[model samples]
Target chain A: MLLKPKTSILQKIYLPDIIIGLWITIKNFFFGKKVTIQYPEERRNYSSRLRGMHYIKTINGVENCTACMLCPTVCPAECIHIVAGERPDKEKYPISFEVDVLRCCFCGMCEEACPKDAIKLSNIYEMSMLKRSVYEKDFLLEQRGHK
Target chain B: MDFIDWIILGIKIGALLIALLSVAPVMSWVERRGSALMQNRLGPNRVGPFGLIQPIADAVKFMFKEDPVPGHVSKFYYVLAPLIAFIPALTTFSVIPFASSIEVMGRVVRFQVADLNVGFLYIFAIAALGIYGVVVAGWASNNKYSLLGSVRSSSQMISYELSMGLSVIGVIMIFSSVNLNDIVRDQGNVLFHLGQFAIPKWGIFVQPLGFLIFLITVFAETNRLPFDLPEGDSEIIAGYHLEYGSMKFAMFMMAEYINMATVSGLLATLYFGGWQMLPGMHTLLESFSLSGSLSGITYEWVRIVFEMFSFVIKVAFFMWFFVWVRWTLPRFRFDQLMGFGWKVMFPLSLVNILLTGIFIKVM
Candidate 1:
């Protein structure tokens, strides 16, 4: 086998990728719309089916939660915690109930497992706080007009 | 100081400030838009009309973002580098003839900020000094990539500058004047006859090859397209500016656009007959009929304003052209790039000089 040294040297490296990449980019610049989305004021619309932050609701100044642990049992992230207490007046209903905001995975399984329509996923995704405790939104209904 | 001199000084200072400030942000938008257009896409349409507010948003982001300085950087020089980078970019614009002179408040106002006898040389010298900023900034960065980038930028500038300088030499030789204004005037006469049409003696016609060489060299020097290896983001991660943050980075951005403006101005002056209108446009405008408002300004002032607008339009076209080429051409490899510059561009420029000399001597 007789291979010329110059050809061998040339064949060792064919560095046309950079140039070709640029050409393609240049072609694309004239051909396609760039996908850098401007954020904030011009927001991307989320799909209706998109899962987001969990919100607990109650009507007639009562929480629908009955110290249920069924929803927490199915959560994968182990990001939820609950504490419950039996009501002194009503034997069937539990009085005290707590859900750790930090631990809750915002999964719809929690909403699905609720005996009543107590837990729901809201469209609100931007949830931030200065402290971990500040993220804790109390589930109790407002007494009169007070929160 | 005399009131008229004060007026001139005020005009000069004000014009510089406005031009310097406005061009930076506007060019950024132009770059993004031009790039998108070249790629057949709409870029940055959300902020303002055609993404005009993108620059503003970017400025705000820069302002609000926390300033970070690398601990490894040479603290003083790193901080000082951007100022050095930007100052020289504006230095060339001092000689750029944007319009003809006009009488303002009984005082004659020249379009340019300054017209040094060494106008052309001053531009070259100032432009050359800019490499120092890149070199220092790169070294001060104390990073391998930035150092490499700076070194590459300096070498590239030095190499292409030879060709660019030589190209200008031909123009200077042919015109027999280094004054930018005089060169434009020299090109006013008809170079060739084509029946009813007299081809204006533009530098493009006189030295087509030289003009091409000059254009290519300017592109390289300004680090736009095909020759943007210095800041090749994919590999180098913004190169010399990798460590910069806040306003420091903004200065570099400002410097690049200003360089674009400087080169555009130079190209307009050197090749496209500066602010001189094409013969047909001039004739049409002269014979035009438009209802005039009752303004006190004379015909000469209006003409000055008109000429200024033309200069701006020309510069803007070149700016867009830079972006167009940037999206059009692929970058050359390091060695191929060097070879093309030293081996190809250098020789071509030398040949251009010889040809120009022969043409000038014989014709």
Candidate 2:
């Protein structure tokens, strides 16, 4: 169904309508609240569940992973690499862990697949870098983001 | 002219040129920020405070950019078009009086560049030539869209100029002079006294319909929004200046803003009591007794300054009004624009002139 708008004689003349339009714009120009956010100095808060950068969780300065290799096995992008080695303090501990961040799909499946709850996603989304590099174990241990 | 007179004339010309040239950059900033405000956004606040210097930065960029003459265009007219467009826009400001005359060094100095006897006729003549720039640019560019834009522009200007000229007849009859200074002086009279409150004989009060017609026609004359069919970006892709680059395009932009300022000044001069002090200013000045206390020369200087200030404020308001209306109204379709001009405004202005003539005759 087509609906025709009923316009009066004053509306047809257009002077009154033009004045009303001008009034609306002037009102907005004077009283409308600005919605711009200065980007560099101000940041918006995101929810804790936001999947951003990958991180390794630690408890009492020790690794929670038992070198089970579950996260790497569950990764869809095949971005995680691990080599397991034993230490005297712990019977089963991984010698090296790296996540290829550039290839990361950020699916959070690896976090879910980890039996020890060692790997977690955090909310540090500003990940621009000058060089392409993998996230090494030592670099991932800094705990820079909010989960 | 004598030596002092020559110096004063030189001063007036220099001041007017500076004021006209500076309006472009200032208006560009205002257009951006003002439109942003209307749209509920903050625009260009990064470069200098509130983006005031953004236009300056843009000017520098325009100056340094590569100015390539497209191989397809007619070289001579392409080079001449921007100059043709820009010069008339600046020249039309010569006849407009910024303030009434003041006594300086035993000589009367008028704050105008050239007080032509046919004041507004000179303006109309010069301003009409600006269309040549657009037309020539379109013809020279060897492009279909540019040609179309130029054709539209010429026709639009010709159609609207008639009604514009006719509308001003009412004002010319009321003021009884073509001299802008005399017209402004006439507007300073008290129309009638109602108890203590007085109504000055401003053109807007006596010639309301004429003012309305003149205002609408001025928008069409300047090729501003609702009448900016020539440079219709969505259709013609910048129209006549489509092939122009760098400083050439900048020249066109400068000419546009300058034309806007000139017409705004013309509007204020004709309708809104140009350089006449605002209401209550006389009472305020009298209450302070500044006129009685000051020496003759000092009082003249003070009055001249105040009048100039008043004129500037009026012109500035109209300038902002151009931006306000630009953001408020959407562009008119080409046929609608022409129809409105001929069918509606043309007949209305004719009626207005007839009515004013009858009113004057009866009185």
The 0-to-1 C-alpha lDDT of every candidate, in the order given, reads 0.78, 0.91
**What DockQ does each listed candidate score?**
0.26, 0.75
For B148-174, candidate 1 gives per-residue lDDT tens digits of 889889889988999899988889888
A1-147: candidate 1 lDDT, tens digit per residue:
988566454443432543465567666765665565456656787776556656557666556666567766777666556656666643443443445567666667776777777656666567575676313336323222111
| lDDT tens digits by residue: candidate 2, B1-363 | 878778888888998999998999999999999999999998988899989999999999999999999999999999999999999999999999999998776787888889889989899999999999999999999999999999999999999999999999999999999899999999999888989888899999889999999999999999899899999999999899999999999999999999999998899899989989888777765654654685567777777877888899999999998999999988899999989999999999999999999989987
Docking class of 1: acceptable
lDDT of 2 at B340: 96
Q: Using TM-score as the measure, which candidate wins? A: 2
Off by over 4 Å in 1: A1-48, A55-68, A87-147, B1-10, B32-72, B102-109, B193-195, B278-280, B288-297, B327-331, B354-363
What's the lDDT for residue B259 in model 2? 95
> Which residue segments of model 2 deviate by more than 4 Å?
A1-4, A58-107, A114-119, A132-139, B288-291
> iRMS of each prediction in angstroms?
4.3, 0.7
